[model samples]
Target: MRVLAFLDGTLGDPSQPYVRVDNTGVLRGDGIFETVLVVDGKPRELGPHLDRLAKSAAMLDLPEPDLELWEQAAQQVIDNWEGSSEIAVKLVATRGSEGDPDAEPFGYALGMEIDEKVKRARTEGIGVVTLDRGFGPDVAERAPWLLLGAKTLSYAVNLAALREAGRRGADDVIFTATDGSVLEGPTSTVLVAKGRTLYTPPPTVGILPGTTQRSVFRAAEAAGWTVKMEPVPGGELAMADGVFLASSVRKVTRVHTLDGVALADSTAVHAELCEAYEAQYA
Candidate 1:
């Protein structure tokens, strides 16, 4: 792992602990983050990631992100990382110590090799189980403090959901709203295909906007596949011709089984989208 911690206007080592104990981000999980895939020393979809990071920071009322500094830190980390064909560059910003709410936000960028499990999931479709998120589709609009759309550092619940799925003998989870509307995976966006048309749940459902999903939709559209964003019921997964969990690190990964029921063979669509996804980075 290679990391570049941003201090004032300079970068420091991340392996060394630099965060103070009183930091609000550490104490209360008050922070925002973005993960980008770095290939050939270049962070893919960097602009989109930074834009989303800024939006998340704004939602949290943190200091405006200094994109130039973040970019510099990311480049430094990428340059330092060795032999990792697909490195994950994570940019994070945290609210400073609780005592000083006006203090500058702490920020850092880290680069590390992709996990072997994630790589295997990309090639071998994963089994997913649906878990209820216990929220309604209109929660984000009705309750701003919930921070539904922001990619905050408070991922305890998400992690627990994945663990629950693992306990159920599934590889991942797709969260659903109280009304049984399929929202998204713990760390990915949900995509379903029926013939040549691709469907994804809209952000209006209180899910985070997916940068990778947007890129894949664009590529799919160019390849003569129709793309649409609408509410997907939990039962729809069983009826779709194919289903996938798309993310920056995982790319486009097929979901072989949903709740122990095998989905229609998506080998052809998976191959098509995988090629389209790789071409974007190529």
Candidate 2:
């Protein structure tokens, strides 16, 4: 039950070829994208995702995204998605035909069912291994052209890290900065809980800001929990009361292990985190 819709209002089956053969997005990976979780029929945190998408476009020196058109297209795809109450929709904007110099920029939205394993991790939790990210926390500010915080279409390194995790018999990864600072997961943001407080690394340290994490923190604050953004050390994750990874599809997922070492069961703590995250939808 996958669906796709173009900005021009064309709706079609995603399996059918649509994008131009020489599209620069496919040839050079020159683009930006966002993954939005659609529950029931509403897209979760659509505004923040679109704002980040625009910020990514600015970082790449591309034209500003047509948010109105994209919103219409994304909603159209969501409306057509069948059989899944929980769907993951991707909105991709790219430089058009590489062979056509005068080609205008174009984009589309595609909707599909979320993977069963990702949903399972929401409850059963995931095991993670820490790997050095090969750069200090200040790299993003020092080297802005590297696009460190942008959600670009290129994710080869992130995908490779997941493969390495599999090789090491781990389910996922929590990347640490070269200076032993906790950065984020390949596809998620890291949050460590300590008693009645929660901490997450600031996005200024070179990670994409997590839309889901922001809402969770707000919900936590409303529930009388202290929330702070700081530079989290890798060791802090191991010693924290609970470690969670936040993402759109997975929401708040508990990190059950680190480097094959079993972490203490923090189910009660994570249950609160889940409730806070889910509060936005309510």
Candidate 3:
């Protein structure tokens, strides 16, 4: 079932048309959003996701979000949910309508079912291909205009990359910077394991600070494993004892193959991390 809640404190049927076409989110793509996990009616890591949404708004020069309004909207949808399983909630805000400077930002929270493929990734893992993101490791410092940290609605490039990945006969893509350093996936963050240690690229590398990745780090540490936030070289993808992509709804998924080459067996590390992560939420 589809559910929606508006910023003006009104709940609407998500299947019906509500968002006007004149909004900048439709015309010029001036908006930000967060897709969060709702399991058994409770939103996990919701506070951090809200905080990140605010940061994204500030980066886009958009008006500050009314977090209370957004939170209530989310709760409204959760309350309306018809199932007791895991669901995805997208919190969104656009720069209002076009040709109206005085218009306040338009915002809402939408609830939808998770994709079957995403659910499958949790158990069967995924095959990924590496693609160049056409930027360097210094992108954050050299080109702050990119706003790579924000989860904006201008996702045409990300969507195109996924299409390219599909054409390449892979389920996903891992982007590498111009400097040949590993960056992140189109919709997830990269995590590598070596022995009992875990590593992920730092935020300074122009990647979004992943909320799920952070939780996974804490989970790993709690399990007596070392966690490091550092630059990951592209070559290390193959050499690492285990490689995984981390996301909110999908949680953690091992990279079964990279460019058609089988990855090192990560079952031990995968299970330990998953156990710790689920326990953290439980």
TM-score to true structure, per model = 0.97, 0.97, 0.98
Cα lDDT tens digits for candidate 2, 1-282: 788999999897778788787888988888999999999999999999999999999999889998999899999998787767998889999988897878898799989888999999989999999998898999999999989889998888899999999999988999999999999999999999999999999998999999888988998998889999999988898899999999988889999999999888989999987887787688
Please name the candidate that would achieve the greatest TM-score relative to the true structure: 3
Q: Candidate 3 lDDT, tens digit per residue, 1-282?
A: 778988787899877887788999999889999998999999989999999999999999988898998899999989889964987999999999999989778889999999989999899988999999998888787777799898899989888998998998899989999988999999999999998999999989999999999999999999899999999999999999899999998899999899989999888789889999999978
Point out the worst 10-residue segment of candidate 3 by lDDT.
136-145
TM-score of 1: 0.97
Candidate that beats the other on TM-score, 1 or 2, i.e. the better one: 2
How well does model 2 score by local distance difference test? Answer: 0.90
Q: lDDT of model 3 at residue 180?
A: 87
**What overall lDDT, based on C-alpha atoms, would model 1 receive against the true structure?**
0.89
lDDT against the true structure, per candidate, is: 0.89, 0.90, 0.91
Sort the candidates on lDDT, descending order. Answer: 3, 2, 1
Better TM-score candidate (1, 3): 3
Alpha-carbon runs more than 4 Å astray in model 2: none
